[model samples]
Target: MALPFARVVFLCRWGAKRWGIATAEARRGITFKLEEKTAHNSLALFRDDTGVKYGLVGLEPTKLAVNAERFLEWAVVLADTAVTSGRHYWEVTVQRSQQFRIGVADVDVSRDSCIGADDRSWVFTYAQRKWHTMSANEKAPIEGIGQPEKVGPLLEYEAHRLSLVDVSRLALVHTLQTDFRGPVVPAFALWDGELLTHLGLEVPEGL
Candidate 1:
């Protein structure tokens, strides 16, 4: 059934107001659709003292498996490759959880602090029911119209920017412009109460 017209209008206004993006032109930059359709099989589990599980299932990309309830214990994982330049994009399907994170990080980033807690990573995260883009010590608030079953991260290296989008809704959640330097890799992190959490990579038709 179609949504009530009033509810649809409310949602549109909510999305734009969710993040204090500051400028209309900046907002436009994030709504651009990606031209590629292939999902890269490049994720790998990045283990640390956080006690998170990561591994590869046959014919599947690396998956981060979490079953604990410790709110401070974060599941940190990374893609198998690093990029120093050019634009890069990928999608991840998240199993339900209280919080989730997606973005890129320097290989040497600190696992002790949450992703984007320091200079090593730039991340889009959900915590305490709020959405944000994080870099260094700054947390950029995002509107998070809804929890997306699928999320895509787009990085423009030369531009030193990162954008988060709801793949299912085809809407931009937020973008972060920063001084993030090169040699970074894709990373994911999440934490929650006693609930099963899984971060899955979406694979394309081609290997």
Candidate 2:
């Protein structure tokens, strides 16, 4: 059975912008493009327009039916999670009500760490952790902000894995295309290589 709620968190190293500032029309465009590219149904993509994007799938009713406890757990975590970044590292930690946590840690491993004998090596890491807790009743608002019209649920089980990468890539490519003045094709792409490596996905060999 599909999990009631699944989220693909995009860990960006450089940009920190509000994802919700993206207009509804822009979200619709992204959704259409996503539908064109993949077999699974599309979900609307909302951007704060500053940097971050929140794309939610699956309806609250269906989510509750699928797994009320897990759905609530994710909702609480999504709302309360913290994002922190510095000169050499960036991290986001989501603490679920159930005590489970998911964290994405990205470090600039290429930087020299020999400044001091006590200096610690910085390496990128992504980890998904789970925990269990007794059930309790709780109520929260569920506004259908970035939900596609066609897809029954806000999210698809299998597609969640790819959506984060796809959305981030689309955002990056779209930005690049807009900035270029003349005909330009992708020459090379730079991303958080460590994140991809941690996910066990191979970076595309070429553009």
Best by lDDT: 1
* Count of backbone collisions in candidate 2: 13
lDDT of 2 by residue, 28-130 (tens): 2111111111111111112221111212443344323232111121211111111231101111212121111111111211111110111111111111222
Q: After superposition, how far is residue 161 of candidate 1 from its true place, in Å?
A: 0.9
Tell me the deviation in Å of residue 136 in model 1. Answer: 1.8
Task: Assess candidate 2 and give its lDDT.
Answer: 0.17
Q: Model 2: how large is the Cα RMSD against the reference?
A: 20.7
For all candidates in order, the CA lDDT equals 0.49, 0.17
Q: Which 10-residue span in candidate 2 carries the lowest summed lDDT? A: 186-195
Model 1, C-alpha of 189: deviation from truth (Å)? 0.9
